[model samples]
Target: LHTGCIPPIVHRDIKTTNILLDQNFQAKLADFGLSRSFPTGNETHVSTVVAGTPGYLDPEYYRTNWLTEKSDIYSFGIVLLEIITNQPIIQQSREKPHIVEWVSFMIRKGDIRNIMDPNLHQNYDIGSVWKATEIAMSCVSPSSIGRPNMSRVANDLKECLISENSRTGESRDMESKSMEFSMGIYTEVIPKAR
Candidate 1:
């Protein structure tokens, strides 16, 4: 869900390519051409034509033609998965073509380590990685109602960062600054989507 507003705006398209990172690695979600806002407080969703990247589209929104903040959550979840695994969202030759399906299969096998990017060389904190994986999985839940709002995701990811920092013995000042930028990305950037 979009943050930093009472009536949150829904950015119907959210993907890794659209997420721009400045030199300092501060993230900014760009490309809001498909954004839509709930016209009234009582309305839960905006009925609109489904439009988004194939790999990142929210299945529920595509099926029902009902667009909501949860749709954005699903796309962002895919982004998270991409960040973790460094794998393409869809690989046709793979048995499980979709990234979510592949990740789920790997998780079922208890192979979290393999699911992570090989480039990491298992240098990350397992607890932190697990937490992030859980958050990403929840964001891609089949039911929109089951998915979390953006604030919760931001907070949970911040916890992951803190846990990772604790492992590496990073300074609290660095954590604070990183978290502040991260929070702005999740809370402020998406809401400004037109």
Candidate 2:
């Protein structure tokens, strides 16, 4: 169903712990106590009292009290960072810095790999990791307008995963071709697109 309608549904609270994984490891978002719906064209952003977890809370919402769909995006970005780095949203270092600040610092230093989970080792593709990290950073940008919409974030992740899969497939094919060529089997070169 390609319903174009985007009814104003506010999640209000979004965090990594609030997300549950099924038997198949599919994510299901939960805990919507602060969720609400506003009629379209009436008022998208509301000047409500500050609510939601501290680390995941939108700075814009905290400053202006204007709650919109982007608030959820900010929270989701923190959740994404948690998933990637396997680190808590708030961790106590020598000086306590939120996950967003930590990530931003690493990104500023041009060493995003430092923030990746050591447990994954070399199993994960670096390109995919970088792409996801970029999306997370965009989501957590200080300006609400700088962050992408939820739908856009979802689409970008999907595309990154797809591209990674395609690259893996291509590498396998090239390796197979190289082995065959070495074994005295003639391999035909595919014509490149103009």
Candidate 3:
């Protein structure tokens, strides 16, 4: 669901595992039981009990029980990081389980070579890689307002992919086929649940 509706549908649960790939590898959103159509205009946010996957949950929503479209953006950011690192939300190791923290640390340390999937083997465009990582980082901003709207994100990601295609000399057709899937946790967080 690309969210073209009048009142945007907020996917309360967004995780990497929930996205499914079709035979053509196009991403598809699954599990819609938890979606709620967000209110628009002067209403700042919807008050509801916070419900979502642990590592993917938005800190702001968890703290204040304020649900907004930005909450879904936060989870989408985690998924982006997962794609970049080819790592699960929580790793098997005890010292560093959260991929988000690990990636942030690695980027901060300027040790990004290890952050990219080894399968990539430096074949991808460096600029595109950085652009994508930056997008993910932007999505995970602690402040919900700090995150870019979906339109901005879509543009940024499109630019990233286009740049990659140009740099790698990949076919134009391949660029059109790129897709992303979103994981959603099914839950109904009633207003009273707040």
Candidate 4:
């Protein structure tokens, strides 16, 4: 999304379902019927009727109807929360039904552990998880202008991944060496057919 589209399009309706996983586990965003092209030079946000899914909609867009890139940032914040907690966007049974609200509440109280999905156990790097959670919170700030741009979000996620990998003491050099050693053995056995 950050690379493919020229002028960059907004998928007006970004939701977990709209993101599909390939056999290899690569994710692809689908369903573009409601997508809109970002405003061209000098134009900021298109003034259009609000269009998006319920749980994922940006409240700012719902109120003033001024659509900005920040609107997508807000929805992405929700997606980030879903990635962490594996919880539904709208928690119907809870007093704070919305996942954003619940997460924010937990973060404000410094009880991040309570916000995590129990299924994760201790398999994850707590530092990375906290960094990501903080980013997600910044994305959903009530004021649209308060949210970080998608590029910032992407870079921060990459940092979180790198940090997690470091915590596990996994090195890229080892992976490269393993691949090269495997290729050397395969070539030696095969010989040349000439």
Candidate 5:
């Protein structure tokens, strides 16, 4: 999703383990061995054999063998769910069997607290967590076309980060810069500089 490449690359595999963080806590995508570029000129997807971790693989891509950038988004969503719930991607011992299903069930029952990682100790902004959960669910939509592009996802998350950091006394200037860049994504709920 680094927008630098001439032809956009689809990271066929994106899991929590493959995302590396540096000393500054910046995340970088790794393991490009399964990456593929979108076909040149107006082509939206590339036909290929499905090759990604089982729990994180995009169901549409696995079923159709037509890979798109959305496949990565789906995988990223799975990672986000894992981070939020701190649960295994798939656990046969659980009735839901998959993280998504468990999260969905919780949401249906209006249990946001259960969906959140307890390690957070109720320190984060609830609105920000709600927004992040919404974004993650959107990313995992069953249809590829239903997924937001990575830029949109990044912008939405930037808003969530801004909202959450605003509570911890991060500088207003940092919030301002991020808000300016992502104004359109979450204008309704973006917290004002205090």
Candidate 6:
């Protein structure tokens, strides 16, 4: 579900609505209106017109008009944050700030629990939630260079899922063994004459 080009391509506009989901809940990226192709070579950045959803736009691109693969990465990071927090990118709470701002503040304060959606309480694993949150924050970092590429993000997510699955399996196996032992089903064999 990823495409790479020489010098790489700039998505320009990556947003939630543009990401279509099928009946089976498969994600398909759509709407490439602002997309532009860049030639592959030794170039740090390319200047282009401002084009993209408001909340998902990269500040750096807006300021310098310089586009790069990292612009898409910044947008994708916002999407990931939305997925984890189940909160819209923008909120109209006078007392609270935007989702990104709020998340950044909480992260800076090292208070991840404060940002988690209360609805997920007791339903999701704490470790996995924190790990996902960390990755999302890293993706949206102010410094584009600090952000990971799409491939790395996907790989990290996959690894986290796999680790959680393995932990669940191990827990189940341990429980089953404990039950068998409690039922006296396992017998300790004593060696006979050599």
Candidate that would win on TM-score = 1
| Candidate 2 per-residue lDDT over residues 28-54, each given as its tens digit | 779878876656785658778888998
Cα lDDT of model 4 by residue, 1-194, tens digit: 53246887887787788889888565778999988887557877889999999988999999999888888889889888998888999878976789998998787788877787889886878778888888888888899889987767766665677677788887654333212222111112222111
My TM-score estimates for the predictions, one after another, are 0.88, 0.79, 0.84, 0.83, 0.88, 0.78
TM-score result, candidate 2: 0.79
lDDT of each residue in 43-132, candidate 6, tens digit only: 778877888989899888888888878888899999988887778898887235567787888777877666777676745556776777
Best-fitting candidate, measured by lDDT? Answer: 1
TM-score, candidate 1, is 0.88
* lDDT of each candidate versus the true structure: 0.85, 0.75, 0.79, 0.78, 0.84, 0.72
On the 0 to 100 scale, the lDDT of residue 53 in model 3 is: 88
Report the lDDT tens digits of candidate 1 across residue range 1-194. 36665567798889989999989888888987888766656788888888999989999999999998899999999999999999999999978999999999998898889999999999999878887998899999999999988877987887778778889998676545556544543433321101
Which portions of model 2 show Cα errors greater than 4 Å? 1-6, 94-96, 167-194
Off by over 4 Å in 5: 172-194
Q: Model 5: per-residue lDDT, tens digit, 32-148?
A: 999998756778788999899999999999999999889999999999999988999998998799888888888888778888999999888888888788889989999999998
Worst 10 residues of 6 by lDDT: 177-186
Candidates 4 and 5 compared: the better one by lDDT is: 5
lDDT of 6 at 180: 27
Q: Please write out the lDDT profile of model 3 over residues 1-194, one tens digit for every residue.
A: 33577686888888877899899777778877777777756776888988888999999999999988899899999999989988888886835678877888888887666888889887887767877888898899989999977766776777677778788786676334563433233333222100
Off by over 4 Å in 6: 1-3, 94-96, 167-194
Task: Compute the lDDT of residue 103 as modeled in candidate 1.
Answer: 95
Q: Can you rank all candidates by lDDT, best first?
A: 1, 5, 3, 4, 2, 6
lDDT of 2: 0.75
Decreasing TM-score order of the candidates: 1, 5, 3, 4, 2, 6
Q: How many clashing residue pairs are found in candidate 6?
A: 2
- Selected candidate, larger lDDT, 1 vs 4: 1
